[model samples]
Target chain A: MSEKNHRVSRRQFLTYTLTGVGGFMAAGMLAPMVRMALDPALEAAGDSEFVSVGLSEDEVSEEPQRVDFSIELDDGWYSSEQSRSAWVLREGNEILALSPICTHLGCTVNWGTNEENPEEFFCPCHFGRFERDGTNIPGTPPTRPLDVYEVEVRDGMIYLGQINQRG
Target chain B: MRWNENDAKTYQSAKEYVDTAIIPLLPVAGGKEQEEAVRMGEFTSYLTDFLERQYTGRVYLLPPFTYLKEESTEDRLERLKTWTEHFKNQGFSHFLYVTSDSRWRQADARDLGELVWIPAFSLAEMDTNKRQQSIEQQAQQIIPLMTEKWS
Candidate 1:
């Protein structure tokens, strides 16, 4: 009876060890595949996606119109809207949405034909200036290009997303 | 040379001469210091005013100005974004005038809802000489554009 009990105990230990090893090997084999399967879902977890600004597709003009509006962004538990303004300059068919905030010092820039200098967005704050294409000129304080906003036109209104400073 | 008729008739004579002569001659001095200072001051005031209207509490109009002394341009920009995120989280509008220059300066102003960059150019009038006078003149030219003033 004692001999039989010892045999049972040995069999139980072998079974547990084999199962543990098998479980670890299975986990190792499955980890990469699981990550691959879940990667896109994890990346898309945040629903703070791009919003569409209501603008007619025909409204986009060759001339840059100052698009001033507000959008609501999720503020943790609550939601809040923030005002943002950008110049949507249409080049042929493509739209280049530029932030009016000067890349030089983040001052609001104005676009008017300077009798002294032709059409350009001029920063009156320190004489820093930018071309109509939102490119910063050398010798100016602003080193980076004006930030561009991801925009999409839905129905007849225009929607904008996060402002990104291009690398 | 004697002061010209332009000197007697214009407020910019002292500034112009300084810009042409004194400023150019100065060694290792950053050009346009005065102009930079005036612009910075105007920006600080504008941003502060915008923030005050947007937020009703914990607005640091003149925060520890020495906040960004050693911070890098990227760090400064990140700090600004962080501040905006914080304000957004608090259900406040995040509106602030960030610096135009790639480098964030030694001084910045922040309230709970806004962060205004007090530019490096604010030091333009520190020296009581020609450059300082030029900055004052430039301030006159730039001040009117900033219609809203923070009292």
Candidate 2:
């Protein structure tokens, strides 16, 4: 049964060793590129995770309040938590969550910052102003209205997702 | 806009829209103290970066102007005025000079720009929450000041 079966041939030994080492080297070279390609897909899976801004349904009122929250962002190999803020208000039966970022630039807009326009949102950067309904005032720097968030109310808690561009 | 190729291109194309220029003045010294100063400067730069991002289209954030702490104030002011003049010629109407060094406060720079001197906050000693809180507080104070200038 025997000596020939128990001992490996030179050709077989060389083929097995070379293939094993070659496969390992190939994987080592391709692993990072594969990860780079798949990273966006992996990150997209977590994109739907809604962050709570710690505001309850009862707390929301007609007056806009600044609500701050943090979100986990994955940029290729780097992962970091970024802080975000939104001006949230309750209008009758609906909730309105508007991004404070000005449409003209990226500056944060304040509610009633301008004493003359107490009902509007005002941008400090360039005097950009928006109406009480988050509409950009005509003749202002901002051409578009403030971005609104997708809101979900669960168990009296408010959850915010991706920002949706509004008119 | 930052002093990078992409932002520079934007600045060039939209010079009319981009009217504000932010210059961060960082002071460096010799020896171990230089390391601490540099670290503080880095934190200051970070704050400027945040400010620039907040008002991206209208504000152009230039890279830090690093100078020796021992350098003459008259000479520095002369050079800074020239720099601001260059920026003004390029269509920038508003100039903001942000620094942690109190020395800049003593310098005559009315022709150069508005000097915003913030007390240096110790980033190394604070936790993330405290650091964020400090940054937010500083930002809150700065926003109104910048807005007043615009008005």
Candidate 3:
């Protein structure tokens, strides 16, 4: 090829450099806005949202303890903080996090609340019972086992995540 | 269950389980400040919402029964009884009343419903966290009273 054809002119060089620099600067300003626009979609796609309930792995015992926690929720247009509670306990090497909502009728179940069912989770509404391991008693109103939350322990802090419904 | 079309559908299919109806009593006219009346309504709503969350399967949260506070106690009682009777006819076995009106305590409203009277306070003056904490504490106190009724 000819020398003039192979070489880049100053005008062409300045245009190429200016376009490259301007593209990067524009992207820098737009990156956050683009992310903000897609924030809800990104959040919906995230499946690993674990929330801490102020209960440590060391604190969890054989007996289930109710711990209250708050999680940020995004509902379409508005985002807000919501309060949630869970019954947590540690057994052998595995930590169990139980959802308090009863499967039969959705009334909250309290552990050791009933005199007759002292060792089990009792539902006062219809006298339903869940075993220590979150199994719904066979003859009880709950057709399925009590839902369990995904448990994660990080640096001794216990984090509870999405419920795994035992259907 | 809340008194909305979506909840009403759930309520129709599960009428046997959803037996309790939560009715709020509000005094719209007491010859008091307008802000005071608003506070009473606000507190009562918070209590009702808390109760519904804890007992959603069994409780139906109805709209408020607003009345003139200047009315005679007998007249209020009689009107409330009419409201209760309608709910009874509709198949509600339990009627829980959440109100900030002190007059309900003195009135012979036993047949009308189980009354939970919470005195009105200025929640607007408090910070967001403090107001939420205060409402929760107040609502928690009413839980045992309801459990007693359930038992």
List TM-score per model, in order.
0.43, 0.81, 0.80
Question: lDDT, candidate 3, residue B16?
Answer: 88
Per-model B-chain TM-score: 0.30, 0.91, 0.91
Query: What DockQ do the predictions score, one after another?
Result: 0.03, 0.53, 0.59
Candidate 1, RMSD to the unseen true structure: 19.1
Once fitted onto the true fold, the runs of candidate 3 whose alpha carbons sit more than 4 angstroms away are A1-43, B29-32, B125-136
Candidate 1 Cα deviation (angstroms), residue B11: 29
Clashes of each: 18, 0, 0
Please compute and give the TM-score of the first chain of candidate 3 against the native first chain: 0.73
Report the C-alpha lDDT of model 2 over A1-167, residue by residue, as the tens digit.
98878899899999999999999999999999999999999878576778888889899999888898888877899998787889998777889999999898677788997888998899877789997769999998899999999899999999999998976
Name the lDDT of candidate 3.
0.84
lDDT of 3 by residue, A81-145 (tens): 77777889877889999998989878888899889888999887767899988889989878787
Give the candidate order by descending TM-score.
2, 3, 1
Candidate 1 vs candidate 3: which has greater TM-score? 3
Q: Flag regions of model 1 displaced more than 4 Å.
A: A1-41, A44-48, A72-80, A113-118, B1-151
Quantify all predictions' global Cα lDDT against the true fold: 0.52, 0.84, 0.84
Q: State residue A142's C-alpha deviation in candidate 1, in Å.
A: 1.9
lDDT, model 3, position A126? 68
